[model samples]
Target chain A: MTRPGRDEDPDRLYTVTGGRSRSTTGAETFDLVTLVVSESAPVRGMQSEHAAILRICRFPTAVVELAADLGLPVSVVRILLGDLLAQGKITARHPRRAQTADALPDPDILKQVLVGLRNI
Target chain B: MTSPEISPPPAAGTGRPAAGTAQPVTGTTRPATTGGGTATGTALALLVSVVVASVATLAAVQAGDESARTAIAWGAGAAGAVLCAAVTVAAHARLTNRSLRAALAAGNARAAEREAADNHFADATVPTVVERLRNGGSAETALAEAPPVASEAQRRVLVTLAREVHKGENMRAAAMSACANAAGRVQALATSMAADLREMEHRHADEDVLADLLQLDHRNAQMGRIADSIAVLTGARSGRRWAKPIVMESILRGAMGRIGGYQRVRLHSTSEVAVAGHAAEGVMHLLAELMDNAANFSPPTSEVHVYVEEVAAGVVITVEDGGLVMGEVALRRAEQAVLGEHGDLTALSGTRLGLAVVGRLARKHGLSVSFRPSAHGGTGVLVRIPRELITEARHEERAPAPPPAAGPAPSSPRAPLGAAPGTPPPAAERTRPAADHSRPDTGPPRQAEPVGTAQHDAQGHEQAESGGYATAAPPPQQFGESGLPKRRRGQTLAAVARASATPSRTADSPHGSRSGADGRADDDRAADGRAPAASPKKRPSGARFGDFRRAVQGAGDPEETGQTPLPSASSPTRSSSLSEDDTE
Candidate 1:
């Protein structure tokens, strides 16, 4: 898929990934919610995107977040992450999806907030 | 010097004979030859005349009486005496002429000797002057470096040469300044065009339009190169300047970005040295020309490889292409072109012009460019930059930057210089990540910031950053790691915080700040390939470009399903102004 903002030739991307189009790790392995964390800091002469990934992943980060953070297409991010993964530079784990209702505040807390608003 | 050991001490400054010149020196020896010595020499002439007259009188005696003969002899003697006096004067003149000629010859020889000495002085002095001027060294320093001369004539000659050299320098400077003023404008226009294209890329959400903008961007970059080349040939500085040293890798990437076939060119760098700001542009341009040549001449399927090595002297860049091997004569001609001897643009065809451009740049910066038969059977061109032009990269500068980015030095004179063409980036531009707006091609911005480790940076970034740094900073740090692609270290806290907030905000509040059917409407608008709504609720308010980045980075590229709009050419006045520059 074509990246949205960028229009550079695939030639640059080809060189970046050493002409690899598929991720070494199964592409399906890195789902949107998958969480990944860097095993180390960025070293000198590391690919800027890779370094950016390591620096940003000082904390666990989701695959989608990594893609957005690096400003790369998810596919490109997967390939780079695959490279890192193969080299043991980072670890990825699938996170179970939490329910949307659980994400909202408790109903009791919501009722107290409504009563407080009425008093004001 | 083969100096005629004759009295030459006084001839130093004048380079002419001192003593005899004090005489009433005439071009011919006859006048100056005449002196008091002729009188005594007349006796021999008088004797010969008397002998001839006696013979004449003897002949007269045979034809007349004794009294007549005696009178004839006396008369003949008197006549002989007068004849002898005239002959003596003529003889004296000749002798004097001979002596003067000898003196003149001696003088000419002595002058030649002084010239040899003057040449000796020039051999030592001219290089010092040239080196000084080329390095932006002071005239006083160059003069101070001139070795002491032995004679007044030497000193005088030196002064005269200095005056002429300075005059030539002034003429060159005047011409360069004039070209610089004009080319600098064109250069600025091209640069700003790049900015405008970027801005449009921000506003437009259409894939087709963005692609078109990229092509326009490419063309603008090429035009900028031509303008910059003209400026360099005219002896003006390159279009852009960096306040701080530029990493060798970044400089290569910057050069690569200028060419149309940049993607086919791959960079392999082992050097970490940075070039001093003054020579950085020259180096970059030189590489661009070489890379362009490599890409242009080689087979379409072939790749151009660049290898950079740091040597004891400085940094060396090798551009090797896998094209057909060049003919010996063709190689020589190409090499000659690289010398840039034919300064007039029309003297060269387009191909030679490219090599000439690179040669001129290399010469100006004191970098050496050499051509060799490549291992791949194509051409291998190596450029060696001198130590003087090279500097150590700052610790932070190791991050790959596409365009030379300013380091810790805040004075970054280039910001204004790059924007100073006519209109600076709009006021708001100054407030954004100055670099983002200042130079859109900054590669290292999305740095794998060695946030906490050194070797980790090296071990992790080596392959990527080396070649990566060599790549133009294509990925904007819009939603970059830590959200602050430009900030690092202690400030990374804020960057990470901002970066974290950015992703969550965009993910949780998809479709911008609007909700319900309106959100769907905004989504429909984006899908329609129309400009996104500019509502105040756009959280990343001024970060419209950022929104475009995420959307363009494929964040929302396809998420806007089937919305379509009537594409309209509605943008800025700058587009027209930009087209005007292209016509020129």
Candidate 2:
């Protein structure tokens, strides 16, 4: 799915990835629901697409969102993120705690945060 | 699994009655184990049914018979209750075993699915890893094998995986083909552009503009060569052709024009043989490659000589150089390069594609090329232009015919065809100095221009009359063999100056003639440029009558007997005695 564009030869893809479809971990470490963040700037000789991915992932972002922003398929994006994660170039975690209703900050704590914000 | 779903709710009804009788046992065991509760409840239900049946039988016997029938009925009820409990327990154990086996099977299926997913990833991931390992100097690492499958479902997954791999292979092949197709299209576009530029070059007339156009034309030819190489690589036939045969001499000149250091190339023994129109470009390419190699390998100061001769089978072109002697291996390589058999891609890749392209063109045209050490101690390449590609050069016949009209005017009845050779030496020698002043190589640059234009017109006429044969420019021949008195050379030089002054008209007819009262007015006009003061009788500049007279005079004089410069210039003599008096 959208591995490369018309001018960029698919053969170049084979050379870039060495014909491997995913990261060294074998399975995708992150999925559409998983959030990812860049750990560092990309290393040299990194592919343009990979560098673009790093630039977009400064903040924690869902895998599906990254794929959408990069104009690549979800599966291909997952593979790229998996490579970065394996290399310690990025980190990923499930945003499961954010889904829990009770984990929201208390009103009194929010009011204090608001006061702190006004002071700043 | 469906059977359990459909019957479990209804079966719970039966469990209720047993639940009451086995209440304590069921309640205690239900929290501990499902198997225990179902077994105990089943037993109690069977016991209730047996007791109810036995009690009814006893009541009926008491009412009908008496105390003896009552004891037998009670004993029968107890035995039936025992049998019912054992059967219930056995059935419950069997149902539990089946449910456990089904659960194990489902677990196994899930594990297999997970393994298959892992295998698919491994199939994609392993090759790159192995390739990396190999690239990293661990060449022994074999490719990762496919993960083993466990069930029919996994086998189906494997089949799908295989199809995907093939689809990827086909996609790569299609991409490669598309790249090749794009290359071919670019080559075609470049070739057409080159042709257009050539047409533009011919239309331009200004000298400086034409020079620039000629340079552009050379670049376009270079581009065409590159396109031809690409086209040949992509399996397309060469696109250049000639409508009519071109002589080997002009072919050599065309090839020479494309190369630098053309001034040092000396062509010798070129025959009046023309190559077939279709094979002209192939011959041009072959000669250019060989000549370029000669120029490059030889010292810059030295010359490269080419000889073209027609043999029994075909035309043989020998290219000789004066340079370092080639080693045995290099000679073999040069030989192989021209024959098109050097299959090593690396050797044939870059600028060295010159000889490889030559080989390709040669093979396409059915020509043979060989290399050997020259007599000059450098490499010599001989290309045999085969009989099929060779034709009779048309310009030779035309060159001699213009001089025929003078033959009848100067001598006997059969003079035009035969005896004009007996009397025309003085006149032929007279025209020699004129041919010299008009020659582009020896004459001043400004004088060369008009002579060139005259030659161009003459060539146009030859092309028209001969149905489009490209002729070589006339080479200057020395007149020493005519044995004319050297004291009269000054007078001949003056006559030459007069004749060369009107180059275009003199070029029209190489032999000027005087034949009045004959209705051949065209011949008279062609001969008008000859000076009336130099000769009382006018003659065509191309007349072979002078050459024929030199031939007869040489036959009559013994000293000059075997000394005709060209065989066509002389005839066999009868007595050879008149030459002795001339020598004295």
Candidate 3:
């Protein structure tokens, strides 16, 4: 484990998220598997954690990995991600629809498509 | 609710003390931080080379043996330089085996390049180059100073000396750089792991698991310090820089947390002091290395006592180990190590590496760390930090009030410590006379007014009331004295006053002694209640000191010194704590 590196103490976690532990319930929410792609490069004088997040998300990335890369808790990273999404600095992609191979396709839709092809 | 890592620390805060000192102060004109006015090895080497070279030149010219003259000068200059610095080189074998062998081989090579060389040279050049190498001067520069010559025996002699010194310096430099780099990488991974542990520590609810994680965290902190030693020894600045000043107590505790035997370390006392943020890391690491040495050397049963006192020179921290005392020779060896004398690799390999680390750090911050025999029969280390590196700790947290009075401006960080009586709080700004009368003039004016001007004070209070409730602040001091026990509360309050509330009124009432006592008791309570929480700016630098003196000095009767605002103000001599002479 690293020794306490309090020297890099930033503006502090409270001020970083405006005391909001969770993302606001609006557009662009984040989940563990949600993907984030940075639209802009990190610039000088940005909140260090935010800059780190921007630099890490060079390609579409997962919220969990971002938390690991930034060395911050998922909750903190979610709040930071929410902020970035709101600022349009990054885009988040939702998780894919869940399904299993055992689940069958609707037979009626398949038959209708077959008849339409025959008619053509 | 206490985490084991957090419990023993004096004040609350995250402890991430880094290792390493700031880069060596840039110029040579200034005395090296290693301390002392005597010339350094580098300077003395130059002086000796010039003197020895000139004497050798004069002797050779008298004999009229031109060829022998240069050789004699080269030999004397080289021998003189080494012998001069050798006076301080405690361990003669400090020069690596590789360098010694190279020098011996160069001597044999020089013997072959005898009479064929006839070129005249600057009398001092060859000897100067030899002196440079022996003093740990860079090899490349030494070679450039006096180049090698195959036919000229004197030049060959100078060339060999330069090459030998280079071999030793280059080896040490390469090793230190590599060690620092490796330690840095390890600390980075450890930092990442520590962050993860912090996260796990929060998510886990099982008491047993949490305890396990705490152990891992402490062990990890110890490892971080070990890595830090490597970087510090290499003379590199590593780790976090604090932007806000950290109180002295917290810095001590942070150092304790980094060592293995922290539990046995007793931080007995710390007066009000704060290290400016930039120098905080170096000071913390320096302390950690010392504490670790103390705790490790002392018996497990005995406690290591640490006392921090504010003195004129700066803050003095005394770390005493209650174990066997260090002998005179050992003490001198350690003193030299910290001062950064001797040679580059004197004790880098053995157990003395810790001392080397301390020396490097002490020099980096210009802190003077000296050792003296302690009363407990163990070694006592005194670390004196210069005043320039400290900022007054803002102990005025509860005093959130905005600046109510106009005279004491906001936050003068270094407000001429002990704002001695010469700059007493302005009389017009205090309006003490007015506040005395305004005390709900309905309260029967409890003060036994020596001057019988209670009515006048009431008028001033009435006028001040219209401007703001400003006059309300002074009444508590007037009314609170008789109602409370004075001594215990008085001293305690004086400590909390942050050196700002001692008005000159304490120094000169007709009842000089009595009013001083009563007014101070009331002032302590009044000041505590009125401390502005929102405006945690600086207070009068010596106000609290003035209060300490007032409380300690004239403990007079409340009735005898009855509050009349003791209109005469600004006598710094009333309480002597106001004088902070920069005495080291």
TM-score versus the correct structure, for each prediction: 0.47, 0.34, 0.40
> lDDT tens string, model 2, B1-584?
22223333333544444444443433454423444465455555555645565566566566665666756565555554444444554555454454445445655786787787667655754444444443332322322233444456755654554545545545654654564566566655654554444334323323344345545545555555555555554445554555556656557765665455555677774265677777886687678778877988899999999888778889899989998789999888776776756433446657776778777777888888888889987989889888998987444223432321111111111111111121222434323433442232222322323333343323222221221111122211223456432222223443333333323343343321211111112112221222122122112222222222222221123232222211211111201121212123
Q: What tens-digit string does per-residue lDDT give for candidate 1 at B222-269?
A: 788888887877766677766567766567776877787877888887
User: DockQ winner among the candidates?
Assistant: 1
Write candidate 3's Cα lDDT for B1-584 as tens digits: 11222222311111111001111222233223321112233234434544554465556556656677677766655555454444323221222222334444555565444433433233456566767776667767777766445445666666676787678767877787888789888777666666566546434424345456656766776787777777776665665566557667557766776788877777765354678888887888888899998988888998888888888999899999988799999899779778876546645677767778888878888999999888877889999989988887543311321222211111111111121111112323233422432233212222433332232222222212211112223212322456542321212333123112323343355654554443443333222222222012112211221222223222334342213112111121211121111010
Question: Each prediction's Cα lDDT score?
Answer: 0.52, 0.47, 0.50
Sort all candidates by TM-score, best to worst.
Answer: 1, 3, 2
Model 1 CA deviation exceeding 4 Å by range? A1-47, A50-120, B1-177, B244-249, B270-278, B327-351, B386-393, B396-584
Please state the error at residue B373 of candidate 1 in Å.
0.6
Question: TM-score of chain A for each candidate?
Answer: 0.69, 0.63, 0.67
lDDT ranking of the models = 1, 3, 2
lDDT by residue for model 1 over A9-83, one digit each (tens)? 111233344434457787567754356778987676665557667754545555544543333434556778998
Which ten-residue region of model 3 chain B has the weakest summed lDDT?
A: B14-23
Q: Write the per-residue lDDT of candidate 2 for residues A1-120, one digit (tens) a residue.
A: 011111111111112232233445533366343567788875433543465566546545555434433333344455677678778888876544443446544545755665686579
